[model samples]
Target chain A: MTDQASDLQEAGGQPESQDNETAATEPGVPEAAEKSGVSGKEVVLARDVSKVYGSGHAATTALRDASVHLHEGEFMALLGPSGSGKTTLLSILGALLTPTSGEVTVSGTDITELTSKEQSRFRANRIGFVFQNFNLVPFLTATENMLIAAQFASVPKRQAQDRADRLLEELGLSELRNQIPSQLSGGERQRVAIGRALMNDPDAILVDEPTANLDTKLGTAVVELLAREIKGRGKAGIMVTHDVRMVEFTDRTVEILDGVVCC
Target chain B: MGLAWKEMLRRRGRFLSVGIALLLINLLVLFLVSQLTGLDEGQTGAIRALDSDLLTFDAGVDQSLFRSSIPVSDVQEAEAVEGVAAVGPVGILFGTGRTEAEVVPDELFDMSVFGYEPGSPGEPAGLVEGRLPRAGETGVGTIDETVKSDGVEIGDTVYFAESDRPIEIVGFVDDSTFQLQPTLWVELGTWQELLAVVRPERVGSEPTANVLAVDVDPGADPSEVAREVDSSLPGTETVTVDDAIAALPGLSEQRQTFFTIIGMTYLAAAIVVTLFFALITLEKAEQIGILKAIGARTRSLAGSVLVQGLLLAIPAFLGAAAVTVLIGATLPPELPFAIDTGAWLTVGIVTVSVAVIGALLSFRRISRIDPANAIGGTGD
Candidate 1:
């Protein structure tokens, strides 16, 4: 067993021998491929990535020669305290921020070399992001928010509407599809945001504290729903969180501290 | 465009407030423009309608019609100048007139007395109701149709307040207003007699004329003839008819004042629009970051803002134009309000262009939004 998986099981107070069986049969958790019969392919590869802000005396290093990889059909949890570079690594992986020095390959494209404009296009087409605050546009209804992703991808209006409707229905938000974010509850708004993230059928999803605004019961339920969607569609996901209790819902957990990966 | 429409719909109150302010501003500007146009036409329409190309007056008079005087000898000299086709002496005097009817009191109305030679080009055209006055006709005059409003008609005798001399109304002319006053056309001999009586000091001097309306020969440049006439007749100045109208006392100054007010109103409207959109963009900064992080291009977002501005501004401009036209049409003739399609078109174009420019100014903020802020980090 990998040291990270062993640590995750220990943190959850589960025996190491039962980790594989528990992950495979949890209904929403995907089987840990290293132990299960299935072998997953790597979809996101980052090598020796480093990000530095400012310069000279004012320079602050956010990431220092850190590396990570995400595999298809795997739901990984990124655990770290404040200012530990977890968000920076996730941003670089999602193409929202550029690494000062590194190589990042996602879905067969070296995103680290892409220009700013090209990176935006790459994010639109290949990666989806769910912000911690459930950043659905306040002016748009849930359906419109979901369709915005497809619209940016240049999907035909009719087809985009159809996909948006299907995603909303699958997320059990059909009744609230026409409600603006202000009118929806915290849990409902997060679901709409997740629906928006999946509208373009992106190759990978980057979630930043998706349950930060919810209660414990609701947060666990939301994360379980995300894990089920990620594994069922065979899409890679890297969820950043500080909640160790939520690690049980993920296949692997990696910890970071002080600009360096510890596990 | 879709996003823009939805945002406007969602925040209709805010957008509507801007639209209402713009509408009121545009309405005020259009009304002022109409009034200025009407006042200009009222003050100079008769002079502009003259068939002659230029007018000659005494030089060093600062282009004031009341201050200018040309001797009959100067008129002959102007006629002899090269390129001069025709020359006719005209005299203008402002005086009060009273009808003989008992119902009309003395000092009843103001009138501009135009004295011109019989059968001269200086005579008013479109005489709808009377014949031109003849030379040596002591008590006959042609009155404009506007005099009908004062209870005077053909064959009625109106006497000048200064001379108390009776002049019979023999004809009526249409649209012959001068200096915002009704006109009464009289023979040059009678006008000279009346002028001598009104200003007795001029009775012993040689006959003098206020101006000489000069026509240019066919295929001749009026400006060239004007220069030649000015040089030919010493102590006399010549200017094209258009220049003479512009030189009218208080006309240019009034126009400039109105234009400045209108320009400032337009500028103020643009600033209001700019501040409005800037505030809206400032409030939506977080939403903008969210959109950018979701893959929206800066161009697309900026386009949405421009579209919103145009959508708001165009409808407001059209509404203001409609209201101005309605008010102008229903106003009484004495109110001096006139609006034309050309003026409305100019207002519409300028207003929409300003609005679009204002919206574009907010684009700098949109382009600088950091998408990383939409995430949960320290917005680095």
Candidate 2:
């Protein structure tokens, strides 16, 4: 834990994104050529994806013939009411559920027909996630919790450590690296979750209400960080959130009601 | 996956509880398997020590020679069978033996002496430490394994029943126990002399032997050879190796009891493992959704839990092994416990299998995790 990391700002006393000003630009990098493997052209594309739970009469449709396209280097929000099937759509995008009928491609490859191992690889390699509860593993140090996720992705130990360290510093959490999730406040833990999602330099970030637990002031700070850091890294970020206030930093907004995309 | 492992570790109490339960269960299974293996080894050793293709006794004789004897002439009759290559007389007698020169109790041990030909049929299979005796001297042999445990050795001398002269210490053999009491070995002539004072009339009228040990032609049907020998001597029993070893009285019951106990203990362990992991899964329902939302595959989640199960099982198995070794080492000399290699392998495999099956409870949780729950799993 160090002084610079304990605070959220960089050592140079500049906005975190300003540190990348000198970074060499990558041209001719096809979205494919981009270092992050997240689908650069359309990170997520759902064509008429639908989900229905239960059976006839009792069956409830969670997602309709819904369609949406997401691309790299964008910050978008999936906004809707509690029962509007927004979360269901997120699950479908995450590949946790097989929509009753639809074609879904993530990172340019279809997910519907991928084998179990491939699905696992897709999750491990291309995707990063931030849950609303800031699901920091309670038993391990913040570092250990982040490393554990890295392990599933089969990231080499040394690399995982290096990535975790760099990300922790960028997020201004270096001093808290050894603290357990239980010891950190809601905002700090959420920031830790964001760091974990970004540790592998994933192609896309799927944040499920990244600031649902924080106060209005902290919630705004969290979303601003996501927009500046996530977009700066040239990765797509599709966040599903109920908080309209957090939607201010987004470049685009898509709303869902009765399982249909409205705007 | 590494992430799942972190999740498991971050939740220390849950992790330890499940791991400890798995460890204890696996250890129990391995220990029990070892005991059963020991029993199997002991039984096989007994059968092997006989080194005979067939046995013969009077029709009225009981399961083993401790309870019956056959005519010495039965030995000759069996040798006459066409397929019988050689025959030797084995005499079983209940007697009191003394380790040294004392009369009342000084090193005296009760034993059943089985007499055998020095170089041929029914010779013991292996030795613990010493060589079998040559003809010029009578080699009094005892079960070598027992001798080691009891601190009895090749040079120890004992006085046999009905004989004042002490038989010279000669050799040590293993797997000669009947009803768990080790038998000693001596020359037939020497035995006959010892038995003379106990049964004076039979010593002269019959000079009968207890069991007839037969080595048949390798190519001959053993059953036919046994029948041929039985026909030559009416009212006498001719049994093959299968009958003598497999039909040993109460042996089947002993085996059945051994397996039943071991199986029940393993079943109980599996159930305990399942319960422990099930509780962990239930408590971590929200965390599971978090993983699912992150695009973690269901099988990877299941496999990670299984890895935890295996880890816990190994230490438990080690603990059980330690307990088994401790009990075995402290057991008195008379017990016929015979654990061996086959037992240890069986234990490890059974323990691991039990642990994995126990963690299957988590597979159900993995399948049901809806990534949507990651958004607001608590519904708050």
Candidate 3:
């Protein structure tokens, strides 16, 4: 926990922007949450992260000195419209995209310092991802899809099988374990995707537009399910979405416009 | 590899289309190889089956058995060389043979008449049934098994129109064609008599042979002995059995032509594989992007594509091989369709390897897919 506080102190000096001070003083966010760098025993932290695409005058600054964090047992929503840089921020934190400048730490390991291969390994073992389209491998069954997450982390087959079975049962997908993604409904597929994200018991789960393809009723149901699961498992999560209505399901919401972050 | 298998099983129709295309290509290539082998064997089987270590031909004849003329004295000289065991004179002449009664009046078949010493290295080996011609037997001969298609049997008489002579077929030998014609093996005296009758230009000339087949001592190297034979007998050239087969007329050119065609066919198969996998990769770009985003390595993804290619190629090869074997069994004896195991294995290995290489062409496209694309797309 002290290491996380030190990481926050290091982040405090990077590009002293007003958004950073505002994020630090947001209401209902305890002083401990600020000092611990977002929540108790932070699972993911980003300090002044900036992502610039291209080179020279053609460079497009996708994210500008964005500082963010996720703590265990906390579920936060990154609210933004199109081209608002929330997805870029998510991509950087997930290790799918590299920050042009700044640092990111996940599971207490500094990701920005690792090589591309090491980042891949770290992503496989420490973080999980859920996509808007519910990117389940169309050919694999629900159980197999969940097990693939464990496979990416090199988990033993038998252990992965047991974990996948338990996750499917928890998600109420046990009856549809052998069915492929095409056979599953929109909400069902998202549930399978959620199950896969949790299969490795990762430190942080990053989801992108999870309810974009679902109806309002099903979308709310899925978000509630995600909130319950994140709270029950005591894991950190960040869901990126444009729908403001979905914000009520999360413990906190961080809004973004252009390339700037606002609390 | 597991993921590849699952996807292939799920998309049977998609894979089957390419699989059937591969099957047809394999069949065409394999059948062409079989026919080429059959033609090559038809031309060189007699020389390839020789029990002799070396053969000597006239120096200026370019190893042609028809044009080369070796005097009887050359056989003696080769026999006298160091490390020499025995030397036999071989004579070849083309003629037409008509089987005895129970056949049509003029059902003549092309035949190559070979003259060699009975019980010598030049004699036909592997008699399918019956015995070789008895020493000093003037009018008895052994015929190639292909002659049976002309209804000529052992104990039956074959009349040669060119030589104005008739001989008894006392034995049959298999795989003994020469110049794509059935061969008839007879004693040297009988061959000389027939030669004298057909070509009367040499009524009182000395005996001659088209080539001299030599057997070397047990401890002698055939190549060394061949060199010695050439040095000892000036105006004569000696070569091992393999060299003799390679020197056969039109054989090397025919082989090269067929190999070129086969190589082009393999290139076309590789192109088909490359095109199919590239299209499939394009279709699954979103899925691949998602996989990479979640942590799939480039190596594993590329390996999966190769695995899928092999999955299609191996079964296609097996199916083609089965059909080739069936075709070989049903083909007529004179058609010369032989099933060569070495060629079959080589083709199978090359086919699978080419398919894998072709699938690897898609790796570039897959590696360039940005995980960022998977973020907001509807995945439709």
Candidate 4:
């Protein structure tokens, strides 16, 4: 636990915004429940999530009784040491991994009750992912990479193409739309990754170390761009990062120790 | 499918390598099939062209034309049998034809001499330029069109290498090759004279034939009549024309050998394609994980892989087909190589099917990929 705290301290700087503590402790309630004019609403909720890998002697608990919430138009930073189960929790929320015992609701649907195939559909239609390495398919051009997500959503080719063009242009990657991942720089590739994630108009974006591969300047710019996109689109976003400078762009930070979230 | 196509286009070098490999394999298969067809035709074309319904040989000779000896008495007995429409004594002997105009080696112009009575069903039909040998004619014969390629034509004199007896070419017939050799239709007496000189001891006191071509009555079953003829004649066996062709020396064995080679080629091609797809699937593991992570269905990912395979296979098949047609068209007529369209169509379908089956080997890998790994920076 001490090592976990030190790891968090090393990754995150001082809280810079007045809303950080409130956002961290009390996630925004859904607009329908609030009965107020606030447009933001809770997009994701995970209750008492626990994940145990393997069985018997080989059993390893990756997440233990962790609960979290993400709201629309808010950026949450997940900070933890290596192997602190921050990724495990994100995977569960994204419906990429099934929890041993938990209820995860995204948008308005309880995803934990869905079948594997339905979960896959939920992930494709409602969740977007940004990986640390900018895992863009190396063989596809930037536009194609973005269109692939739309394709999975069964969007018509013409519509998908239009959406892809709009996203690329929005990401300031219009000039490099024809370039493959290998032809793009680190920042450009990460932007393409973001565009791909947003192509499906997912309810929430799950980002895992989006700036780990970029230099300080590029990394900061990339995070700022992500923050602007989330706020501009009013989509809920959770970014997992080990770099401290990236915390400035997020609305709140939740640190994980061992496998539980820390206040 | 668009993603699949774009991937292929982006990695043209890898796909092209597989495509070229497939092309070479298809070409080899097509060539072998064409060669088999041509060789089959050359070996049995004359026998197939015969008008007889059944061919009878001496009993106890296992359907072998070379070993069969039908005595003149057996021929009479077969003709006397019920449902026997007509009987023609046809003798086959291998010999060489030589022209005085050139001193060419006899081996280069070896001919299969088919002896038949005038107006008999065993005689070659479709004379392009000349007529059949006259009855009882001892010094004249008709040669197939192939003889013209060897500088022999109508009215030209050719002598048997053994007897040196001059035979005037009285006619030219089209497509009369036998046992992969040029054929010459001679009067039965002329063939007997040459045979007596070549195998004096084998030609006993009575004249003998290698086979008796029997035409069955139109309404009668040839197999039944063949059985009756075989029973009525004390020392004879009967077979249909097809059976006789299959019984030709070394023909069945050659067909089996060619088929075995073709089967192995198909198996090898399938294995090669499987290996190629497997390697490509391995290389794309991370990309597949990412796609799955982004909500790409397993079906679509697997479909993409299959589409990639087809993109390579279809063009390769077309290229091989074109190349085969080109080669078949340009090859010299003397070579025993014929391209049967039916055989080629079968090969084409099988090639594509095998390619698809090969691509299926990667489906399991694609389906098992964990999408979770894609986000953790650990999939690759």
lDDT of 2 by residue, B227-273 (tens): 99889888778888778766677767777886788788778888878
Question: True contacts preserved, each candidate?
Answer: 0.61, 0.53, 0.61, 0.74
Lowest lDDT block of 10, candidate 3 chain A = A9-18
Candidate 4 residues lying further than 4 Å off, grouped into runs, are: A1-38, B72-85, B101-108, B125-131, B134-139, B201-207, B217-221
Point out the worst 10-residue segment of candidate 2 chain B by lDDT.
B135-144
Window of ten residues with lowest summed lDDT in model 1 chain B: B99-108
Q: List the pairs of residues colliding in candidate 1.
A: B130-B171
Considering chain A alone, what is the TM-score of candidate 2?
A: 0.86
Task: Kindly report the interface RMSD of candidate 3, rounded to 1 decimal.
Answer: 2.7
Worst 10 residues of 1 chain A by lDDT: A7-16
Docking class of 2: acceptable
Clashes of 4: 2
Candidate 4, position A254, lDDT = 92
Query: Could you tell me the TM-score of chain A in candidate 4?
Result: 0.84
**Residues A1-263, model 4: lDDT tens digits:** 34322322222221222342232333232221232134667888999999999999999999999999977778899998888998998899999999999888987899888887887788889888998888888888899888888888888999899877777765667778899999987777887888888888788989998877766777777787777566556578899887878998898999987899987
User: Model 2: DockQ against the native?
Assistant: 0.39
Over B57-90, each residue of candidate 4 has an lDDT whose tens digit, in order, gives: 8778788767777775566777789999888888
lDDT scores of the candidates, listed in order: 0.81, 0.71, 0.82, 0.81
Stretches of model 3 off by over 4 angstroms after superposition? A1-39, B101-105, B202-204, B378-380
Using TM-score as the measure, name the better of candidate 3 and candidate 4: 3
